[model samples]
Target: MAGKDRQITLRFLAEPADVNFGGKVHGGAVMKWIDLAAYACAAGWSGKYSITVYAGGIRFVEPIHVGNLVEVGAKVIYTGRTSMHIGIDVRAGDPKNAERHLTTHCIVIMVAVDDEGQPTQVPEWVPVTEADIKLRDSALRLMEMRKKIGAEMAAHVTPGG
Candidate 1:
């Protein structure tokens, strides 16, 4: 979490439609949740509209079954011209289990856009706390990895979208 943005907390509940026949929530569903959480974090920091432009490492550590209460937290870690890197941590709080389990973790990059839908520069967000620093460092590393993967994917892109 970014230092000044410590006031951030985004929550969402896992629903039936989010689960697969296997009874576990689908990874794509979780990604959607992360996207929303990251957008909220970026919006909170930018105080304006932000759109996701890139996505970093998305790792699923545990299964989130149906009826689980999913709590996701996102915080801005770094900022560029108009882009902000936000760290997303998703946890599943099951009534059956006494402790919440970490389910998914990812870093989503969002860019503040103008009304015309072009990327626009925004103020940089500073990390104020140790936690924020740690998260930011992790996000930066993940960002590098994502860039490499993106380049690899681009090299294989065909004429089709």
Candidate 2:
């Protein structure tokens, strides 16, 4: 992986087909963009294929309107043996306007994969900037909360329930 490959960005216009019946962009469409951006960042950093294992705290803070210029930014904030923790920000605004407002944010975990599609080791990432350090620490702090939520969700799901 190149030194500067840890971050990836994508920008495009939110099309009419991406909207919900209410005329706002669908959350699913945003999530799809997020996933794509995450994959690109993870793959670039790992120098191999990567798959999303988990996406946490997807916050849809604002509704996006069609024709808005949507931008998705993905960066690897932390890394484990085979997983890269990516933070994604989705922003949008009028194409004619330069200013963009954040619409959503999320944290996604992607695992590097081998030819057999099994988890593979990825190059470790070390924090360089202050922002990277803070984001990495934030990811560490979320582990306990994630475990609790996972356990609670698991308990709610019985064999067929």
Candidate 3:
């Protein structure tokens, strides 16, 4: 896979319409941005249309102001037969100062799909750099944790409840 296909970054200004009653960009808006970036990264890497299968571990570290410059970065850290694990980082800060800091982070799972929307196989991602290896390991750890969490949650549910 080409190096450029593994990542994507979106930069834009947070609009006033994105603000919440608390006068900061709404959490939902940030989530939308994250989804958009993740999709772009997944599609670029897989060379096929992709859809989000799961998104979790979203942490809003800091409030993003309406006028702040927002950057959402997404990278494909791991791949399954049909799924890509994307690591997304959302950062925002004053546009004038040109300084930015992390505001949110999450992991999104995207599945490549064929024209009929069936899951399609994607090229496997192999980590080459130290950062890439670290992120891939992190994704693997998260996947294991999610499985345990899912089993625990299922144990608590009752039939037809």
Better of 2 and 3 by lDDT: 3
For every model shown, what is its TM-score relative to the native structure?
A: 0.84, 0.95, 0.93
| lDDT for each residue of candidate 3 in 83-105, tens digit (9 for 90 to 100) | 99999999999999978999999
63-104 per-residue lDDT for model 1 (tens digits): 998888788888777888798988788988876666788989
| Top candidate (TM-score) | 2
Best by lDDT: 3
Give the Cα error of residue 6 in candidate 2, in Å: 1.0
Candidate 2 lDDT, tens digit per residue, 31-110?
99999999999989999899999998999999999999999999988999999999999999999989999999999999
> In terms of TM-score, how similar is model 2 to the real structure?
0.95
Q: What is the lDDT of residue 14 in candidate 2?
A: 96
Query: Among all windows of ten consecutive residues in candidate 1, which has the lowest summed lDDT?
Result: 1-10
Error of 2 at 128 (Å): 2.0
Task: Report the number of clashing residue pairs per model.
Answer: 0, 0, 0
lDDT of 1: 0.80
**Residue runs of model 3 more than 4 Å from their true location after superposition:** 1-4, 156-158
